[model samples]
Structures are given as C-alpha cells and as structure tokens.
Target chain A: MILTVTLNAALDITYKVAALTPHTTHRVGEVVERPGGKGINVARVLAALGHECVVTGFAGGATGAVLRGMLAPLAPHDALVEIAGTTRRTIAVTDGTSGDTTQLNEPGPTVLPEEWTAFLSSYDSLLRDADAVALCGSLPPGIHVGAYAELVRRARARQVPVLLDTSGEPLRRGIAARPDLVKPNADELAQLTGSREPLRATRDARRRGAHTVVASLGPDGLLATTPDGTWQAAPPEPVRGNPTGAGDSAVAGLLSGLVAGLSWPERLSRAVALSTATVLATAAGEFDAAAYERLLGRVTVVEHTQAASGK
Target chain B: MILTVTLNAALDITYKVAALTPHTTHRVGEVVERPGGKGINVARVLAALGHECVVTGFAGGATGAVLRGMLAPLAPHDALVEIAGTTRRTIAVTDGTSGDTTQLNEPGPTVLPEEWTAFLSSYDSLLRDADAVALCGSLPPGIHVGAYAELVRRARARQVPVLLDTSGEPLRRGIAARPDLVKPNADELAQLTGSREPLRATRDARRRGAHTVVASLGPDGLLATTPDGTWQAAPPEPVRGNPTGAGDSAVAGLLSGLVAGLSWPERLSRAVALSTATVLATAAGEFDAAAYERLLGRVTVVEHTQAASGK
Candidate 1:
C-alpha cells in the first residue's frame, strides 16, 4: 500500500468568471470545491488507477471535515489526523474567456509540536505496513522546515522507498535525507539548482541526494536522471486545459509504476501519459482510464547515456 | 426586537495581500472569517450595540456550520435553519498598500423548494415578534426573486416596518411589495432607477413603492428621503479606515435608533455616527462603543424641506 502525507491539505475552490478585474466585485458563474493538497492529489489519482493508497495528514475544523467528506467517495481507505487549527482553502478563479487562472492561497493551519509528534507516531506505525511513501506539499505553520526530512528518514528506516515532492527550503532540507525520488517541475528545479538548463538542473538535483530526479517541463514533457542513466519522455502534444495538478498526477503515475515493478522506461512512459491525460481531463489531477490508455501509446521515452560520474 | 433575514448567509473570508494581479498566485498574509450577508452584518452590529436582534436564515453543510459557529459569539440570538445545500463563501482580497479590495462572491448554495418553504414558514413566525424586519443580500439559487417581496408583504400584514437591502432584479421585484425603506448605495440606486444622478434616482426609487429611500454615498455620507423631508447627514470629515461593512453598520445604527424611539434626525445622526465609527475601526462592521461615542458629536445632519411635487 502507498502511504501519502499531506501536511497542509486544502479545500480547493475554483470559480469561473467572465473576466477577473482587480478591485472590482465579480459574481462567479460557476464554483467547484474538492479536496486538495499535493499528496492528496497524488493519492486520488493512484486510487483512481486501482492502487491501494492511504492518505494521512493534518485536518481540522469545518473546512477539514468538508475536505475529508469530499475525499471519502474518492479514496475509501484514508486516515486524516484531526488537529486544532482549521485547514486552509485555495481559491482558483479562472477567466472563462481567456482560460487564465488567478490563485489565492491561504496559509494553512498551524500544527502544534504535539500534533507533529502525533503525526510522526501515527505515520511510523502506518509506514511499517506500507511498501512506499510519498511526502508532498508545503509545510504548514508551526511545522519545522525539516519536517519532511524527518519523515523521509523514518521511511528509510522502515525500508520504504519514499518520494519527496515539494519546493523551497523544505525540498532543500529534505533532499539531504536521501529520498528514493524527488519530482520538481522545471521552475522548481531552476530554483534548486540556480540553473535554467533542465538537464543541468536535474543533474544538480541528483547531486543534492535525491536518488532519482524527475523534472517536469510543461509542454516539453519530463526529463529524468538516475544512477543508471538519463532519459527524456515526451507526450504526443500538450492538451489545452487546466494544468493545476498535472505534476501531482505524474508523481502518482511514477509511484504506481514503481510499486508494480515496472521498468524505468515504462515508469517514465506512464508518468508522461498520466500527466497528459490529467491535462485533458476536466478536473485537475484526475485522469479517465480511457484517456490514459489512449495517451500511453503516444508517450515516447528516449533513454540517455549516463554521465562519466554516473549521474 | 429587530429581525434580520439572510437567505444566503456567507462565511466572509478576508485575505490581506501585498497586491492583486490577475492570473497570478498570491500568498495571503492575514485571513479573517466572519459571518456575513447584509442582514447578518446588520444584526451583528445591532447586537454589539446592546439591541435585541434575531437572525434567521438558511445554513447547511460544513461551511454553514462554520458560519453558525462564528455567529454564536456575535449575535444575541440566531435561528439558522438547516437547508439542503451549503452556505457560500465570499473572498475579499485586500491590497494592504493600496487599500483596494477585490471581491469574489460565490453564487450561494442552491436552496431546495422544501428549504425555501421551511424558511418562509419559520420566518413568518419570527416576524410576529419583530418590531422591524430586514431582508438582505442576494438571493441564492432556487430562491425566487419575489422571495423578499413575500417577506415584505408578510411584515406589512403584521404592521412591522420592513427594510429591503439588495440589488438587481430582486430589488426591482421586491419594491412592488412596498417596503417601508430601501437602502441602496449610489451605484445600486443608479442601476435600479436607470439614472446616474443620486438625487433623481433616489426620488425615482421612492416612487417605485418604497416609502423611503436612503442612499449611502461613501465619504459623502448618507442621503435619505421621506414623505415629510429630505435630509443629508454627512460625517463632519472622512475619518478614514477600511470601508467594508460601513453600510451594514449604518443600517444597524438606524434600526437601533428606530427601536429606541428617536426622531428622524437623531436616527440619521446615530446612523452616520455608527457608520463613521465602523470605518474608523480596524475590522469592518465592528463599531466599538468608544469610537461611536467619539464620533457622535462630529456627525453633521443637514435637513431639507420636501422637494416640490413637480420637481
């Protein structure tokens, strides 16, 4: 079973308006709410793909309850630790005409030290039964920057291959704990490596202690590097739709393939295909089986020769 | 007792950000949640001022629960009927540097026919004990435009004064029921009257079955027209701060004075004082007694004789 940890889960709200004008009142034509957070998205896609996954994270207050309620139908077996502070909400207002999105993210609930300790204890017990773990999303207030690093260390101790996907200082700190895989989009890779070139940035990320680095380049597809070799996987083409959780879907695809014991090339192919399918799907991070099947054949994976240092 | 009805009460969420740019993501610095809807806001302020107020509205789902939870501490009494759908949330993103506010209002949850029937029946019962009733804010989905009109008629039958505060077609249709008072901001008054001029538009609004019309002109203060007189009550000077909820606070002041048996000039003075105090307060719609007392003497009430019938 795959274990997913989302420290800062959110009630994601999307509003569709004719146009978004600053300092003006807008009446949204459509509003949709869903459970959200990077790990939650990955767990949802994995569950949809018929994988056994358990999502454990901090949830509190009414918003947290609503988020959990929304997730019940999507992922039947999940554990959300109730905390004191309420979960945050992210508002995504999309312009109906231009298809542009404006996002307003609330700083998530603060997790007390005792709450973190409780989560760690619960997670350790859960990880003992899990084959792999995926630690995703931002650290909520009151959580130390090295919280994900500690989780990665615990997963390693339990012999569980962990996938870490986050950005900024959290990712910087977490990489030192040597997670099995780290997925950073092109922009995050640049921030991590201080380089614009994707190939160089992926290599730099690997050097920072991530065993495998998967760099998602929007439209250009995925660039990955491991000790075995480097590879580039490209979808047939970019589909026009909301790309909100495409990266998280890719994380789900990669983890699902790994748990199924698929080859690296096959894993890359699955990741690219699932991400493309997610973009084509109406909802973010959601991919229909037919769409994924149709896109799988179109995802092309080209392996690259390992560098002299074997990165 | 003052009865306030918010058919579509909301959890008003305010986020303070550095600035607002369309199609971009922003991390909010501060978040505040308050129970809201025009009538709810009015009721809260009235309660704060030691007035006996009852708030009746439809609330459902988790968000509605949060709204009710937050309202418990603010209102003297509340009767939030459980409905079929959740209450909506309105997000106001305020730019700290510019003091500009961008509002994104959700089309509130759909009220089922059964829910509306339940609300109307309960509301009619509540009105029997009410000295004055206020029907406020936008109608939720599945609620007819004539809902407020029906409430107005009910209040009329009981000889209870009713104030209608809303915009668009609801206001247009509700006016036919001949509410005792209609308070519209300049822009809303213009929309209702098809005249940009406040004076002409207010007169037009009064002719449309509203016995009295009160137009709130932000810094210019309040304008009211009655059968006996036309009065303009302007605060001595603009005591600047956040203008959010100033209108609702003004309504609270007006209702408080009416219940206290104050004359029109005294009622207008109290309204102006409370409105100014709200603007001076750090939070919207919250008028502290100290601030209200400080501003009471500064409010300037200018009374005008009734305009010639031809003019």
Candidate 2:
C-alpha cells in the first residue's frame, strides 16, 4: 500500500457564479466541495488506478470532521491526527460565462510542538507497512522546515521507496535527505536551482541528493534525469482544462510505475498520459479511464541518447 | 423575550486580503466566521442588549453543524430543524488596503415538504413563550413564497406582535397577513409600493395591511407610519463603517422596545441609535454599548403631524 501525507489538508470549495465583480454581491449558482491537498489528490488518483492507499495528515475542527468523513469513502485508511485549530477552507469562484476562476486560500491550522511529535509517532507506525510513501503539500505553520526531511529519513530507514513533492524550503530540505524520487514542476525546479533551462535544473536537483529528478513541463510533458538515463515523454497534443490536479496525477503514475518495476521510459509515458488525461477530465484528480487507455499507447517517450525515437 | 426565526440560516465567512482581483489568486490574511442570517443577527443584537431571545431555523449538513455550534454561546435557545440539505456559507472578501468588500452568497439548503411542516410544528411551540416574533430573511428553495405570511398569521392568532423582514414577493404577500410591523429598506419598499418617496412608500405599505410600516432610509435613519401617527427618526450624523448588519440591529432595537412597552418615539429613537451604533461598531451584528448610549440621547424623533418638531 502507498502512504500519502498532506501536512496542510483543506476542504476545497468551488462556487459557480454568473460573473465576479469587485465590490459587488454575487448569488452563487452552485457549490461543490471535496477533500483537497497535494497528497490527498495524489491518493485519489492512485486509488482510481486500483492502488490501496493510506492517507495521514492533520485534520481538526468542524471542517476537518467533514473532510474526514468525505475521505472515508475515497481512501482505504484514515490516519489523520486531530488538533485544536480548525482546518482551513480554500475557495474557487468560477465564472460560468468566461470560465475565469478567482481563488482564495486560507493558511491552515497551526501545529503545536506536541501535535507534531504525535504525528511523527503515527508516521513511524504507518511507514512500517507502506511499500512506498509520498509526502506532499506545504508545511503548516509552526511545523519545522525540516519536517519533510525527517519524514524522508524515517522512510529511508525502513528501506521504503519515498517520493517528495513540495516547493521552497521544505522541498530543498527534503531533497537533502535523498529521497528515491522528487517531482518538481518547471518553476519550482528553477527556483531551487536558479536555472531556467529544464535540463540543467533537473541535473542540478539530482546533484542536490535526490536519486532521480522528474521535472513537469506543464502542457509539454515530463522530463526525467535518472540512473537509467535521460528521457522526455510527450503527449500527442496539448490538453486544456483545469490543471489543478494534473501534477498529482503524474506523481501517482510515477509511483505506480516504481512499485510495478517498469522501465524509466515506460514510467514517463504513463506519467505524461495520466497527467494529460486528468486535464481532460471534468474534475480535478479524476481521469477518464477510456481516455487514459486510448492515450497510453500513443504517448512518445524518447531517450536522450537515442535520437528522437517515435512510438 | 423575543423569538427570531431565520428560515434560511448560514455560516457567514469573511476573508481579509490585500486586494481582490478577478481571475487571480489571493492568500487571505485573516478569516472570521460567525452564525448569520437576518434573524440570527437580530437575535445576537437583542442578546447583547440583555434580552432573552430564542432562535429557530433550518440548520443541517457540515456548514450547519459549524453554525449551530457557534450559535450555542451567542443565543440562549436553539429550535432549529435538521434537514437533509447542507446549510450554505456566505463569503465576503474584504480588501484590507481599500476597505472594499465583494460578497458571494449561496442559495441556502432546499427544504423538503416534510421539513417545512416540521419547522412549523417547532415554531408553533416556541411562539407560546415568545413575547413577540420576528420572521426574517429570504425563503429557501422549495419553501412556499407565502412562508412569512403564514408565520405572521400564526403569530397574530396568538395575539403576539410579529415583525416581518424580507423583500420582493415574500414581503408583498407577507404584508397582506397584516403583520404588526414590517421593516423595509428603501429599495425593498420601492419594489413593493413603486414609490421612491420614503413617506409615501411607508404609508402605502401600511395601507396594504400592515399595522405599521418602517422604511429604513440608509444613513438617514427610519421613517414610520403607524396608528399613533407619522414619525421620522434621524441620527445626529451618518455613522459609517461596514453596514452589513445595520438593518438587523434596527430590528432588534424595535423588537426590544415593543416587548418593553416603550412609546413610539422612544422605540424609533432606540432603533435609530442602535442602527447607527452598529455601523460604527467594528464587526457585523456587534454594537458598542458606549456608542449606543451616547447616540441614543442625540437621536431626534420628529412627529410629522406636530408640525416638524425639532430636538
């Protein structure tokens, strides 16, 4: 079973309105809510792919209670820690006419020292049974920046394959623990290595202690610099829709491949195909199964050494 | 004791950010949530003034659960009915720099036929001990348009004074029930009686079956046409801040005075003073006691028939 951790989980709420005007009132046409955070989204995609996944995170107050209840049916196990502060809610107001979205994110519940310790204890027990672990999303307030690094170290000690997906200081610190794989989008890679060139940034990220670096190039696809060698995976065409959970879907693809012992090229193909399919899906973290099946055989994975091999 | 009925209650959420721009992302700096709806706000103000208030409405789902828990400490009694649909959340994004607010309100939970019948049963029992009843806010979906009118009739059968506060067709139909009092803001009154003139609209509303019609004139206070005579109450100055709950505060002031058996001029004075103080207060549904006390003595209630009496 894959274990996923979301430090700052949220009750994601989307409001549909006719139009959004500043300083005016709106009568929202519809409201949709779901459990959201990087790890939760990844777990959802993985579960859809027929993987048994355990989700652990901090959930508190009324919003947390609602999120916990929603997660029960989506994931196999719930290992969320209870805390004092209320879990935050993230809202997206979408304009029905234009499809323009306005987002407002709340800083999540602050973690106390004892709460962090309690979570660490829970993590230690969950990792014993986890075949692989994915640590995702931002570090909540009051959690040390090295929280992910400690998690990576604990997973490594158990000899479990761990994937770190985060940005800024936490990502930088987590990389130092040398996780098996790290997925960073273009901007995050550039911010970490200060190189606008994707190839150079991915290489530099790998040199920082990550065993393998997979850089997501948005609509283009996934680029990986791993022990097997460099490979670039691209879809047949660009897909357009809400790109919110595309990266999480890609991470699920890569993790599933890792556990199944697929070649790096095949894994990159699956990641690119799944990410594109997620963009085409109606909601975030959900991919059309038929679309995924059709696109899987069409994805082109070219090894850097082999001059542009076609599918 | 005043009984306030909020057929559509909500969990009001406020997000404070630097600015709100369409199609962009905002990291909200602060979040504040409270139980809200027209009657809930009025009951909170009444409770603040040391009045025993009972609140009843439809509160269900997760948002409703959160609202119910929050209302426990604010209002003395809770007679809210449980329903299948979740109560809605209203969001106000306040720009910290410009102090401008953009609001998005969700259409509240739809009440089933059985739910409406259940609420009426609860309302009938609560009215037995209520000194007066205030029916407030919009009718949720599936509820009949004449909900307030039905409530007014029931209160009248008990010989209890009822104040109907709503707008559009609901207000029009409710006035025919001859509620003892109806408070309509200038726009609501204009829509009901097709008159922009405050005095004419108030009189027209009273003639349509209401025993008393009080029209809120924004910063100018209230104009009332009642059996005693015509009176206009004006505050010393226009109190300015967030005017979100000013009208609810006025309703609380009026209901408090009616139950205490105050004279018409005194009731008008209290209503004007409390409404102005609410505007000056920092948050919605909260009034400064010191400000209310100081404004009360300065509020001038002029009897129109007395040939324009001045302070």
Candidate 3:
C-alpha cells in the first residue's frame, strides 16, 4: 500500500462564471467541489489507476470535514488526523465562454505542535505496511520547515521508499534527508539550483542528496536522472486540457511503476503517459483508464549517460 | 419571536492574505467561518442583540452540516430542513495592506422539490409563533422565482409582518405577494423600479403592494416610506470602517426595534444607529452595545412629505 501525506489539504471548488471582472459581483453558473492538495491529488490518481493507497494528513474544523467527505468517494483508504483549525479552500473560477481559469487558494489551517506529534505517531504505524510513502504539498503554518525531512527520515527507518514533491524551503530542507526520489517542476528546480538550464538543475538537485531527481517540464515531458542511468521521456504528441495536477499524476504514475517492478525506462514512460492522460481528462489529476491506455503507446523514452554513471 | 428564512444558506469562509492577485495561489494569514445568507446575517446580529429568533431554511450534505454547526453558536433556534445537495460557500479574500476585499460566491446547491416541500412544511409550523418573518437572499437553483412569494403569502396568512429582502426577479416576484415590508439596497431598488432616483424608486417600490419600503443607501443612510410618513434617517456623522454587512445589521436593528414596540421614527433611528455602529466596529455585522447606544442619540431623522419628495 502507498502512503500519501498532504500537510495542507483543501476543498477544491470550481465555479463556472460567464466572466470574471474585478470588484464586481458575479453569479456563478456551476460549482464543483473535490478534495485537493498535491498528496491528495496523487492519492486520487493512484486510486483511479487501481492502486491500494492510504492517505494520512492533518484535517480540522468544518472545512476539514468537508474535505474528508469529498475524499471518501475518491481515495481507497483514509487515515487523516483531526486537528483544531479547519482546512482551507481553493477556488478556481473558470470562464464558461473563454475557458480561462482564475484560481484563488486559501492558505490551509495552522498545525499545532501536538497535532504534528499525533500525526507522526500514527504515520509510523501506517508506514510499517506501506510499500512507498509520498510527502506532498506545502506545509501548513506552525509546522517546522524541515517537517518533510522528518517524514523522510521515518520512511528510511522503516525501509520504505519515499517520494518527495514540494517547493521552496521545505523542498530544499527535505532533499538533505535523501529521499528515494524528488520531483520538482522547472520553476522549483530553478529556485533550488539557481539555474535556468534543466539538465544543470536536475544535477544540482541530485547533488543536494536526492537519490533520484525527476524534473517535470510542462508539455516538454519528463527528465529524470539516477545513479545507474539518466533518461528523457516524451509523449509523441502533447495533449491539452487542464494541466492543474499533471505533476501529481506523474508522481502517482512513477510510484505505481516502481511498485510494479518496472524498469527505469518503463517507469519514465508510464509517468509521462499518465501525466499526459491527466491533462486530457475532464478534471485535473483524474485520468480514465481508456485515456491512459490510449496514451501509453505514444510515450517515447530515450536513455542518456552521465559522465560518472557508476557514482 | 422573529423567524428568518435563508433559502440559500452558505458556509461563509474568510481568508486574510497579504494581497490577492488573480490566478495566483496565496497562503492565508487567518481564516474564519460563519453561517451566511442575508437572513442568517440578520439572525446573528439579532441574536447578539439578545432577540429570540428562529432560523429556518434548506441545508444538506457535509457543507450544510458545517453551516449548521457554525450557526449553532449564534442562533437561538434552528429549523433547517435536510436537502439533497450540500450548502455552498462564499469566500472573501481580504488584502492585509489596503484592506480591499475580493469576494467569490459559489452558486448554492439546487434545492430539490422534496426539499422545498420539507422546508415549506417546517416554515408553516414556525410561522404560527412568529411575530415577524424575514425572507432574504437569492433563490437557490431548482426553486421557482416566486418561491419567496409563496413564503410571504404563508406568513401573511398567519398575520405575521414579513420583510422581503432580495434582488432582481425574486424581489420583483416577491413584491406582488404584498409583503408588509421590503428592503432593497440602492442598486436592487433601482433594478426593481427602473429608476435611479432613490426617493422615486423607493416610492415606486411601495406602490407595488408593499405597505412599507425601506431603502438602504450605504453611507447615505436609510430611507423609508410608510403609510404614516416618508422619512430619511441618517447618522449625525459618517462612521467609517468595514461596510461588509451594514445593510443586514440595519435590517436586524429595524426588526429588533419594531418587536420592542418602537415607533417608526424610533425604529428608523435605531436602524441607522446600529448600521453606523456596525460599520464602526471591526467585525462585519457586529455592533458594540456601547457604540450603538452612543450612535442612537446622534441619528438625525428627517421627515419628508410625499409632495416634496417627488423629484
């Protein structure tokens, strides 16, 4: 079973409006609500892909209850911890005519010290049966900057592979704990490496103690490097729709591939295919089996060699 | 006892952010949740002022549960009927620097026919003991434009004074039912009357079956035309601060004063005073008793003869 942690879960609300004009009242034509957060997104996609996954995180207040209820229909298993403050909501206002989206995210509720302790205590037991752990999204307020690092350390102690996906200070701090894999988008990679070049940034991320670095370049496809091999995987064609949770979908694909004992090239191909399929799906981070199967054959994986491949 | 009906109740969520940029994600500094709808806002303020009020409406799903939980702390009685769909949420993002607010309102869940029947049945029983009833806010989807008209007719059957506050078609349809009172802001009044002139529009509103028309003009204060007289009540001085729910607060004040057997002038003065105090207070729709007491003495009530009121 895969264990996913979303420190800052949200109730994702999509509102369809004729148009959005600043400082004016708008009557929404449609509203759709779902569970949200990078980890939650990853877990949702994994469940849709027929994977066994357990989601554990801090949920609180009324918004948290709504978030959990939304998750009930999507995820396979739930072990979310109850906290004091309510979870936040992220609003996506889409223009019905133009299809352009304006997103407003609420900063999730703060996590107190005792809540963190409770989560870690419960997570230790959850990790014992988990094949891999994925720590995803931004940490809520009051959590230590190195909170993900502690999770990575715990995963290592349990001898379970861990995937880290986040940005900024938390990502930087979590990398030093040497998670099995870290996936950062182009901009996050640049911030970490202080370089615009993807190849250089990927290498820099690996040098920061990540065993493997997967750099997701939107539309351009996925770039990954490991101690044994380096590869670039690209879909034959770009599929366009909503790219909101494409990265999380890719993380789900990669974890599913790893658990299936697929080769690195096959894993990269699966990740690229699933991410592309997610974009083509009606909702973000959700890929139907038919879409995934249709896109699988079109993904092309190319191998690259490092100067010091053995290291 | 006062009965307030919020056909489309919502879980009002507020997020305090440093600033809001369209399409960008933000971490909220603070979060607050309250039960919201115009009538719920009125009920909260009335309850805070120590009035016996019963809140009734259609509530459903997890979001509805959250709304009810939040309302539990504010209202004296609850007669919410369970519906098929969850309640909606309204998000207010406040910019910490300039204090400018950006609002995003969700289109509330559709009220099924069974839910409407349930609510009307419950409302019928509650109306038996109600001295006054307030029909407020927009009609939720799936309900007819004349839903409030039916509610007003029911309230009138019990000889209860009904205050109808809504906008556009609902307000237009509701007025034909001959509600005792109708309160519209400047914009809603103009839309209903097709006249931009406040006095003319308010008088026009009164001519269309409403015994009394009260128009709230924000900083311009309250304008009312009853059978006894036409009066414009303004605060002695402009009280400046947040005006988020000053109109609803005024409605609460008017109802509270009327229930206490105050005269029209006294009710109008108290409405203006409470509204001014609410604007002066830090929280939306909340007025400090001391500030309200001080402002009451400073409200200026000006009487206008119908002949002179014609522009």
Give candidates' CA RMSD values in order: 2.1, 2.4, 2.6
- Binned by DockQ into CAPRI classes (incorrect, acceptable, medium, high), candidate 2 is high
Model 2 lDDT, residue A306, Cα:
37
Q: Taking the tens digit of each residue's C-alpha lDDT, what string does model 1 give over B163-274?
A: 9999999999998899998889988898999998777888899999999888999998888887767888989876778888899988887788878888778888899899
- lDDT per residue for candidate 3 within B238-264, as digits (tens), equals 777989889888888889887898988
Q: Give TM-score, chain B, model 1.
A: 0.95
Question: If scored against the real structure, what TM-score would every candidate get?
Answer: 0.95, 0.97, 0.93
Residue range with the least summed lDDT across 10 consecutive positions in model 3 chain B: B20-29
The positional error of residue B65 in candidate 3, measured at the CA in angstroms, is: 1.7
Model 2 misplacement above 4 A: A306-311, B306-311
Docking class of 3: medium
Judge candidate 3 against the unseen true structure and give its global Cα lDDT, from 0 to 1: 0.87
Lowest lDDT 10-mer window, candidate 1 chain B?
A: B302-311
Candidate 2 lDDT, A1-311, residue by residue in tens: 99999999999999999999999999999998899898998888888889999999899999999999999877557888999988888999999999889999998989999999999999999999998999998988989999999999999999999999999999999999999999999989999999988888998999999999999999889999897789889999877888878999999999989888899988888898899989889875688788898999899887787343211
lDDT of 2 at B211: 99
Q: Best to worst by DockQ, what's the order?
A: 2, 1, 3
